[model samples]
Target: MNKSKVLLLKNCSTGLVSQVMTLIFQFLTRSLFIRYIGIELLGVYSTFTSVLSTLSLAELGFQTAIVFSLYKPLAQRDEQQINDIVNVFRFVYDCIGAFFILASLALLPFLKYILTGITVTNAIYLYFLIQAFSSACTYFLAYKRSLLYADQKDYISKIIDMIVNVIANILQIIAMVYFKDYLLYLVLKLMQVIVSNIWVHWVCARLYPFLKRGKINFTLLRSLFSNVKNIFAGKIAAYVYSSTDSLVISAFISTVQVGYLVNYTTISQQLKTLIAGLLNPITPMIGNVLATDSEGESKEGAFKLYAVMRVLIAMMIVVPFCVLINDFIAMWVGAEYILPASVVVLLVMDLYIHFVHSVNVDFINAAGLFREDRDNEIIAAVLNITLSILGAKTIGLAGVLLGTVVSQMWFWFGRSYVVFKLCLQADKEDYLKYWLKNIVDGVALTVSIVFCAYLNSRLPIANSYLKFVCSGILCEAVSVALFGVFHFGDPEVRKMLKYLVNHIGKR
Candidate 1:
């Protein structure tokens, strides 16, 4: 087995545990949050986070750039180069944090105009300030965490996050039960943020004890800055993609609508984060491959990974949306919070696009292909913002989501093409052939799973938990069968299946 792949799996395993912990905690906390903060403040909290996400453009993609930069130097164990990269990022992050605080303060007063139909609270500005402080602490001190990731120690950070999240959330949940104050809940969160940041900083120091602060080398910094510029654009575009729906809905519709949307979105985001954990560990490993592997090998490996991921993720997403989401909303939140099928479909499509983006972006970032797709990212962002505002004015929530999906389609193609042609140096046919096959396989799996879910739904299952379980099992079995047949000819699929069988036999 490849050592790097082993490390990736290890990180993924730990990350998975963390995400499961998070999901459990979040589920427990949601009722308390809704009770204490009420639906309106919940909307305010959602809007606040969205606004913060929008302003995170100040992060300027240095996280990606610095992490990308460290892959090579860390591979060589060149402490000097690593130190320079860290210092460069530290300096950049410090400035970014300071700038964000200033700009957000300047913009806070205008949120009155920006967010309509939402009653502003006296503690609103205080909430913003505390959240900003949390964000600033993260930006200024979290740069070292990237160093750990580049060194394949991301499990450390994930573990720390898990512990911090559990402790902080338990305390916050208790505070909410008693005080029912958003401000106090946020205060608990702020304390947790500071603790998490400090803990990670300490971990980095312990891991790299020999390292000390140093100025960035001019030449290396300039080269890295070139990559950072394009990455910054992409980061801004991504923030807009993720944050715009709440902003649009809060402004045009109502805060209550935003609350309703987030009820479903909370599920979407949790699933997204959980599944995304599986991809994160592999990304820096992808950078290693792009840096070291031959062109043909890199192309073949990337295509296989992307194809497998697409098939797996499609089955994961589409089946749930089909069999589970409607009843899920009814059981989890309420039927009233469930949107029209048209809107849910749009939301699922958006989720799918972003999910696949994880795969595309890994290769692109790994190959340092930022500049090639920078213009496309900018255009996508512009189109999304413009169309979202216009569409929301006419049609409301669904229209805003549709605008995002349309814009994602715009640049998703560009990013994939650049990865195939520019990064992997492969033919368009090389990409299209496998991509088409994987998408077809995924669609087939989705149809089969949905039918299974339909049949499962007809059975006498009064308990929603039992219903979810029955459907989940049926979907998985059907998906496995479909995947096995569709990918019978692919070596990667065969290898993984054989490994699974052998492992099971051994067990």
Candidate 2:
């Protein structure tokens, strides 16, 4: 395999491993916190974290833009340019951190108004403060880590992140189990953030000693500032649409409801992370291909990746695991906090739509077409928030999901398709034709699998667990076989699979 492809696969593998560890840690943390602090406090905690995540827009899109901007220069082995870019990013992030601290402090007076469902006794202030500090530390750490990603050294970064997170979560869980104090838990969380940042920076410096040689250059700093200013504005708008829904839900609904919504969203987000784990390590490789290869080859690779990602993500998202979820949550968190059926269904649908968009969105972002991408994001965010509010009032939580689907279809998808076409210089007619064919194939596969699963469900199985396992296995087996016989036999699918198999064999 080529060096870039090798690096991409290695990074993807590491990222997948990290995701598995992180998911396990999240499961443990959620289980322990729900038990130790109960549902209400967990709701407050979720709200606090959501607010903090929204506040992370303060760093703008500089972190992402920096990585994309640096990739080509690094590929060219332009050390001076790399150093200059890194210096500028570091300076900008430091300023952003300072601004976040000031803004968070200024908003203290209206904290109660900002954070709905927070009680005086819930230590909401302390939670926000801890979260804010962690955010600041993360901003700095991210600036340094972007260089690793730009160089496709993401394996290193993911490994460090996985180790730190696993250790820190273990400590946090131990503290919670032993102490069961919110303040102490918050402190441990903050300390974990600090230590993780330090470790990331230390590893980064050790890996690239030249990073330590780079001095902050003011002229490059100004240029980066100019580039990032508009990017940041666009990112803020995107964050509003992406991250503000939970806060709005918390404001309009109850904190307990937010807790339940968070549970469903968390699962959806986990699926997203899984998809990202599968796709993201290819981003820098995409940049490398675009830099060093022919446009035709690059476009071919992009299309294949997009197609496979869509199919895999759809299968992961659309399959009705609701019965399994109901059982799992009941067994895990008890029936008291189990999510409503409507909410679960809504989340699943939302995740399916989101996954479709996620697979293609990276193509635009990694192509350095940020202006049009940002414009689309702004439009989508406005529509999403507006519709979400309108929908929430009419349909409750499901309305939010409906709003996301509408925004995605009407705003994000078309724009993303346009961006992808422009980036790859692909023909619109061909693109649509391919996607249409894939849709037909997908529907056929889905229907056949569902039919088999339904038939399997009628079997007189004494054990629900065994029945679930058997049904799932049967569905997957039938789906794969049908897809291979019908869809995978198509020339494009066969070609892509051959390419993948050859690539794997070479590696």
lDDT of 1 at 353: 68
In the range 1-507, model 2's lDDT, one tens digit per residue, is: 899879878888888888888887887888888898777777777776777777677776778678768978887988788878888888888888887777777756766664556664436666767777877777666678888888888788788778778877888888778888767777878777777778778887777667644678877656666667668856775676567677767766666677776666666678778877776756766777666766466566665656665765465445645334655576566777776667766665566556665645666656766666766767777888888878778887777766776777654466556654776666778677656865675576457546765767686887866766776666566656665665655665666677889999999
Clashing pairs in 1: none
Q: What's the residue-level lDDT of 158 in candidate 1?
A: 90
Q: Please, what is the whole-model Cα lDDT of each candidate in the order they appear?
A: 0.79, 0.70
lDDT of 1 by residue, 1-507 (tens): 899878877788988998899888886787678766787877888887888887787777778878878999899988888888888888888888888889888987887866678666667778878887887778877888888888998989999998999899989998889887778898888888888888999988888986787766777767877777777888878887889889888988886788878877878888888777766656667777777777468656755766576566766676666566767867776666677877887877777767765567778767767788788889999999999998899988888988998998887777878877887787768878756874676477556756776777686888878978787777777766776677678777776667779999999
Best by lDDT: 1
Q: Model 1: number of clashes?
A: 0
Which candidate number would show the highest TM-score if scored against the true structure?
Answer: 1
Clashes of each: 0, 0
User: Could you report the Cα RMSD, in angstroms, for every candidate shown?
Assistant: 3.3, 3.6
